[model samples]
Target chain A: MSDKDTTYQVPIGPIHPALKEPFMINFRLDGETIVDAEAHPGMNHRGIEFMGMHRNPLKVIPLSERICGICSIVHQHMFTTAVEHAAGIEPTNRARYIRTIMAELERIHSHVLWAGVAAHEIGFDTHLHFTWKVREKVMDLLEYIAGNRVNYSMWTIGGVRRDITEKMYPKVNETLDYYESLYKKLEEIFLGDPSIRLRTKDIGILTEEEALRLCGVGPTVRASGVKKDVRIDQPYAAYGDLDLDYVIPSRYGYENTGDVFSKTLVRLKELVQSIDLIRQCVDQMPEGDIDSEPKKAVLLNKLKKADGEGIGRIEAPRGEAFHYARLKEGQEELDCWKIRASTYNNLTTYAPMFMGEQIADIPIIAACIDPCIGCMDRAEIVEINSGERYSYTHEELHVLSVEKTKKILEGSL
Target chain B: MNTIDLPMSLDELESYFKEGLGDSISDLRKEEIKKGLNNRPVKLIWFTVSRGSFRKSIELISDIQIPHLSVTSGSDLGDVVELIYHFAVNYGYPGDEVSVNIKVHLPKDDLTIPTITDLVPGAITTEREKQEFLGIKVENIPDSRRLWLDEGFPEDRYPWRWDETGMENMSRYVHDKEEAANPPTEDTPREGGGKDE
Candidate 1:
């Protein structure tokens, strides 16, 4: 209580949107500068792993996709791959290519959707609307391929449930071409815009040492000069066949500051990278069956008798995530299933990033990680000395962020 | 963050561990799942280590490079809790990364494993998680306050355990009342793993 007498505690929380996974953070502040930020995630731990463990292997496929609303494909892909590896079922080469294409398309849409959120966080609604509008092409492409916008239930135990027929190639190419065309404009707006640079540059810096020491992943770590992309490091699916490089800030001559700006740069570049990867997969796709074991009963029987543990790690749009699965002989359900999302690894890195940022920078910094769920729903500022308590709604926090942008534009504190 | 000129293959890595921690390792397996046009090898080495040598094995891994700790995946195997430390090495090099999963089985009575947060600070999350979900005590974890589960939830009942301490009685399906109350958890055949979750 004595320490609180000289400091304030700002708890931002209950970022629970529609009862999905939620997150919260408590910021210890002296004046407007953040001294330390402690994150309290798991506000709504749905016990999906518990749910998965209770069901059969085939039944868990749909359940896995429901783990994350944004990256349903990532969970589905990882679950199937883990089960397949345990059961010793090799997916066809064509199926791997199809999976890769779908994963990349999801990345495009996720990153684009994040751009809008980041824009909104910084009070740039115009950019948010613009980016959201630009995001339709990728979402359309995903829906066209998988038949669903969000939960594209494409994965089966052995392989994908659907095929990317020759007829779909034209649509896929058109979508990729659309992103390629808009890439420069998207870059100019996010990276070239003066206001965004002012707000993001030198804000929420996570040094390379901290990034590595904390084991950060995906664009979050890549932005900090850590070359830890799962696609390149360990090629799963069609990533081995496709030539790719880590989308670190240094690749394009920008310093790896690990700030919000560098993170934005990394995600934007990854957008282009994903487009190129999908094109590579399309060009090099082999002709074969999409599903290795189409009959659910047959595959279920195989998984039930399989006795092994397997791992599926992927470079999700957010970062590196993995699913671990174990199947014992004669067991109808999984013996063990552990789902580790990228955010879990990146969670520790937040304390370092928020060390010296202003309270206004919290929203953008939190959004910069592109956490699976919205995290800035509301905030309560506790003046510890007086024991006075008041809160800021998500909209009020948005105003503070926008006001910071306006102050930067006006050249006044 | 010392750099080795050439990353060792999965075989060499396995041999390194066996030679270094001889009797501490068991059930050693090295696999490569080939994929796509190039048939590039995705290597993985699975080995179970004695509880005493768990930290020692991690120290051996750090000798090569600051291992990228993916996550520690674990489950309750009735008598012993099986904790698998899923780590990745040779990260910078393209297509050279090997997943080294070190399994440590602790008797339910002991239910304790030393923390690797000293070697991999990032492992605190997974360590704390293993502590809560499976009721495994993470000895000397820097900060052991509950991570995922809230303060109100019953601390004694771990969700992952399929035992008396587990949430089996509480975990249920809406329609399957009888099935939920008396769930089928039968064959714990090999190495103490259960038949079903």
Candidate 2:
């Protein structure tokens, strides 16, 4: 705790206030500058992969959706696509476009949600409120399409559960027009703000070399100038039919410094790109059956007969989300199911990014990668060794967070 | 960005591994699921090799233009547990990306394989995870600590295994009033509770 003590180590959390989910970070510091850092994630692990193995292919779709609250659609999309791939059931062209539209809509909402969180971390509450207000439109569109706001159970093994009726087209177009019109305003608030630039421009810089070496994916890698996107590379859904562009920082005015600013720019550009993608999917959507085979019993029979494996991946809002599935012939349950969320790939880069950053920049730097511990938290119910259930109530957790914030503010932490 | 003779199809990619690695890979099979439900053709190359050649096969896979290590997952396959290392090659190119799966089967008697963290440091997390959940010991891994499992979690009680010693009872939620009233508790003599080493 003393300034003279060179070997000062500060442990952040298994549960922290700034983070949306629970994950611990230990920072080894020399005075105020971090010399080394380690991230201990998986506090909220629900053992979703383990759960998926016991359930049939048709039943695991909803379980996959619960992997993360933000990127629920991406999880479902990947899992269903993998199962569909393994079963050799090709979805109708209309179904593929619908999937594409839903995924892009999810991306728009997710990016805006992340922008608000990043803003709040920097103590800019107004930006958080405004960004979230604009984000509601996307959420509403999602709710209208799938009947739920967060985990839309739209993805089925063979095809989507619901169809976008002709009545919904005007509503979808209106939402797109609104977002396109607000793009300049959103850019001005996020990119043009002087304070935002000052806080994020040079902080948490991840070089292209570090990015590739660490296997960083999604916007995190894009921010670093490594032009890789699973959407562009392995064009799934309706992504192949539509013309696409990779959203990298250098394409805009910013240099490929891979800083928090670069990441922010990439995400903002992606929001616009996602808007364009949704428009394209809607316009080019063909008229056909959503499912190759609609009956549940027949679909299950097809999956049962298929003795093969396939891997499905998509560029989620944060990064590349992958699902690998193996189905044995004449088996009700999955032979093998593995999910690798983007946060899992992105977390490896944390040590390098946090190495030389000051303690004050920890929140922003950590938030810059958009680390979602919920996706990585694969916890299991192990018997408590202490023979005591020491669980915190919501109020207690809030009070503890407030006390920690106070300590951080007073600079005694 | 010079396309210096990239493998044009799944067969070319498979032959590249065969010609390049020789007998290091004991069994090799490529399953091409051509544009099934999507435009992306999944070229899955299943490489089964002896435990001794596991790391070498990965290094050879890395030599194929530094493929991104997607995820390393394990499944209990009767007497042997199959550890599948999924890698994505040629990203950012539409319909050119290949899913190269290098699978190594380790018998239940000897549950260990050399770690690829040195080749792909990003693989440390997945290796650690496979070490925990599937009980597949990753030798010479940079970090030996548990990745996600709780500290009090009993050792050798892998969740993925449906066989004996696996915690299959907890897989599904059954409303047992007796178990709920008094949860099982045995002190695990481990340091840092559940923190990584």
Candidate 3:
């Protein structure tokens, strides 16, 4: 096609080499700048929310875990809390403390995962490998406590399913100490590297005004100088009791670009804060039943007339997760259950952020908000040729197979 | 901060709503429930009018507009589908929550209701998803685009349909197969499948 008749369109994903998931984005580019972008998110719509309404509360707990693998515990925590709130039962003090510990542990693991991904995005493979090696400590601790690496069904309706045993305290402490040392190493790598600063600083900048208008939550909002945190504003899960300081990125030493650099700094600082919070929970341990005795008589009686409405909001690793449930009398199932994740609220602003960014900076810009592409169930990539298309799975790119190398060597050598 | 006595009678709560919102209300009653539960005071009020009357209901409670729409939940209860619009009003002075349930019944075929999206933008996604999921058509909604409907789940397939999914059949077959394969033998009544047996 000649230049006069040709149109420049970049199709990203459904199958992309960079992205870890399946879904596509079509970007209409004009001279290295994105003019218009369309997002398609139905690649892995498992109908989890629809499944939640029909499944019994007990079964829904595990279903929630499958929503996002990285933040599996937080999903179950939010769902169980919503159910408990609807039933008008608050977990015991001991249970609340246990819940907080589990959540912070999740935050530690998730942030480490994000850091590794961010490093890999910027062509820093060594940093990625080292960070992930450190991240295994947290994952191992999770396994020891919950008996599984990923989908730990530790959260129950009224309280946590498993109590923190006395034997696990030392292991938890050792894990925290390891993470503390890892944090210092990551800070040195992220903050001290000139190439990383050049790549990330002042790129994908989200101003305070834009952040507020877009209703961006969590670290994205915090990096933009918004001091609002759900844990501080509406304290839950023993966060109110813990005397920990909210970590906000400082504008002084680092350039307050409100870009990916600032966001990375904020997440790194929060990692340190999470480590401290875990230590506090372990030290100031409370004594009581991890779960209150089941109110069988009340539940059975209420099961007949137990129709009520309740809203449960929790600050998950990504952002605030809202669950609304209503019970109808004499109904064997819930009348209605509505859920809104933080990512659902944040996706509205992606178009505005992607508008003026250079085509080369798309990955870093998207990662600035700590974009959970998996949550969106979508991918973002650019197609260079019109008729020719290329695609690769995440396993092929991230986890290189032996066959890939054998073919390449056979051809080249 | 009005502290209503515990287990307040249905008549007493009706008078409170009438006095609170100066409008002549009717059909205020306690929803039927099983006994032996910890009974918290609740009142359901149904307006004796059409969709336009919702504005009047809103105006009556304008003074107490602190009410948050907990959720706009719809369900297909087999016979007559029900749309339970739950609103919880938080009085600053009182530390308690006063929940009011406005129940509207729509015929199974024509499950259309005037959209409340204009009143609350947050309700837009929930209402649209419900319309697409349960085949409840919410009229006047801004974005009528199918949210999760692109999955070829079929219109009104309602993944929650237990009879259609045949989970019972699957569970029964699996259970029967397990029982037959490992029938409790007299030598090993507990079915431990010991080497001796």
Clashing pairs in 1: none
CAPRI category for model 3:
incorrect
Winner by TM-score? 1
How well does candidate 3 score on lDDT at residue B145?
Answer: 73
- Superior candidate under DockQ, 1 versus 3: 1
Q: Candidate 1, which segments miss by more than 4 Å at Cα?
A: A1-4, A16-21, B1-4, B173-197
Candidate 1 at A50: error in angstroms? Answer: 0.7
Q: What are the per-residue Cα lDDT tens digits for candidate 3 across A1-413?
A: 22422335666555432335555556666666766665544556666766676666666778888887778876787777667656666677788888889999999988888888777766677887988888898999999998988898888766788889779999999999888877777998997777677667777777766665444567876777755465654455777666655455764365445677888898898898898888888877688877764654554455446576555556777776667666667765665666666665555445666676666655555566665563223222434454444443444333322232233345641
Each prediction's DockQ against the real complex: 0.70, 0.39, 0.08
Per-candidate Cα RMSD to the true structure, in Å, reads 5.0, 7.3, 10.4
Question: What's the CA error at residue A115 for candidate 1, in Å?
Answer: 0.8
Indicate the fraction of true inter-chain contacts that candidate 1 also forms: 0.80
> What is the full ranking by DockQ, best candidate first?
1, 2, 3
Candidate with best DockQ: 1
- Candidate 1, number of clashes: 0
Overall lDDT per candidate, in order of appearance: 0.87, 0.78, 0.62
lDDT of 1 by residue, B133-178 (tens): 9898888999999999867667677889998988766665323444
If you score just chain A, what TM-score does every candidate get? 0.97, 0.89, 0.86
In angstroms, give how far residue A171 of model 3 lies from its true place: 1.8
